[model samples]
Target: MAECTEESTMCDPRHALLLQSVQSGLPLVHRPYAELGQRIGMSETEVIGLLSEWVAAGIIKRIGVVVRHRSLGYDANAMVVWDVPDGRIGDVGRRMSAFDFVTLCYRRPRQGDAWPYNLFCMIHGKDRANVLAQIELLAASCDLTDVPRDVLFSRRCFKQRGARYAARALAAS
Candidate 1:
């Protein structure tokens, strides 16, 4: 068995082949992994096993759709950042995420006196008015109105893609 650390998780020819083939895309068929396996000369089970191992080894975070909200008719996307008391971040963040309008929520490091916001949430709606309304409602509902916060509505999307890591494997003859 080729354990993930056995040149399979990273810097392995086999792994590179798999990554390059799928970098463009996975097959659109029902059994995409199976299709990939067939193209890469591996059994479906083998493909699945390799993927599982890679994920466990942190070589892969996740494979899912990268939905373009604006293309999907959602014109309003606002990133709400909050500066809650240090002790309340976890509780406040979890509460903020409970709102149906809050699509994405996470925490980030705060820059002392400069930019104090640590918790962030993204709210998507049909339009700017709708998004602002949701944010107002969130403030009241989540009891964050008292908390220092700012809403940065997206002006335009510059880029959205998967992570690009520099090559670590030199081609082998």
Candidate 2:
């Protein structure tokens, strides 16, 4: 494979336009990429192919549907926090993010003595049983059996809304 260079990513004018096309977001259609292609003057295949290449090159970290769970019948969500070592945090974080049940996973800067946990994952479900089972499975699968951790379930969901990259997203359900 050819090396992905700084110039290819940063200096390309088409790349900038392409990024902008989706910055606000692709049209809320059945085929978002096809709509994007039509607007950007590229074939749907070309658009998808380029995106696939970008993902392979790690230019795009991930493509995911960000659902506002509380609005979608998920009543309980646990913010599972881990006090993992700095050296192993990256490995642990990646492993934690791999779980399908882990809806959101990221790291936070440790707040010294007040807060010791660095890595965090959000697991949302209708009840605690399913969420707890997922946590157990995650711990075992990721070799996090004895890691220092805490599970904080949400008492209330004060804010529940999907991310607004575009002005609208179609919802037929």
Candidate 3:
């Protein structure tokens, strides 16, 4: 096994190749790594090591799947935004993130005039009403009654993929 240095972790050829392959999200078969390794001039173990190292170094934020909610019967998904005080945004975000039903929670730059929300969360459920109920519960739990909020349900999805940076890197290479 090659000793992975900090520099090697960032832009090594093997790591780059593994990143490109993972970003593509092609179906992983019985010998997925081995097949990928063959194309990238590495063995399966080497590919695994490169990925593991990248993860440890925070180069790879996550390895996961993106499911189409509508196809899976979870048709109702909403982007719930809150106009939380700057001081309490972190506390509110932490509380929101603690909920299993809250899939994504983060702070975003407030859009002037139309959008006043600074904190955002994503809630998914079987129906729009169910999703609203979940958001209501979340708001009550976070003592967010005084805060203004809006829920934006996605009407259409243009594109969804993992690791946009990885895709750009592959394109560059």
Worst 10 residues of 3 by lDDT: 1-10
Which tens-of-lDDT digit does each residue in 105-153 have in candidate 1? 9989999989999989998888898888888887887677898889898
Model 3 scores a TM of: 0.84
Please give the ranking of all candidate structures by TM-score, highest first, separated by commas. 3, 1, 2
The superposed Cα distance between candidate 1 and the true structure at residue 72, in angstroms, equals 1.1
Cα-based lDDT for every prediction: 0.77, 0.76, 0.80
| lDDT (tens digit, per residue) of candidate 3 on 46-156 | 877877877898877776776877789877889899999999999999999999989999899998878889998988788888888898899899999889998899888
Please provide, for model 2 over 43-87, each residue's C-alpha lDDT reduced to its tens digit, 9 standing for 90 to 100.
889788888887999977777776667878897889999888889
**How big is the positional error of residue 112 in model 1, measured in Å on the Cα after superposition?**
2.6
Misplaced by over 4 Å in model 1 are 1-24, 29-31, 38-41, 52-65, 165-173
Task: Give TM per candidate.
Answer: 0.73, 0.59, 0.84
Show pairs that collide, candidate 1. none
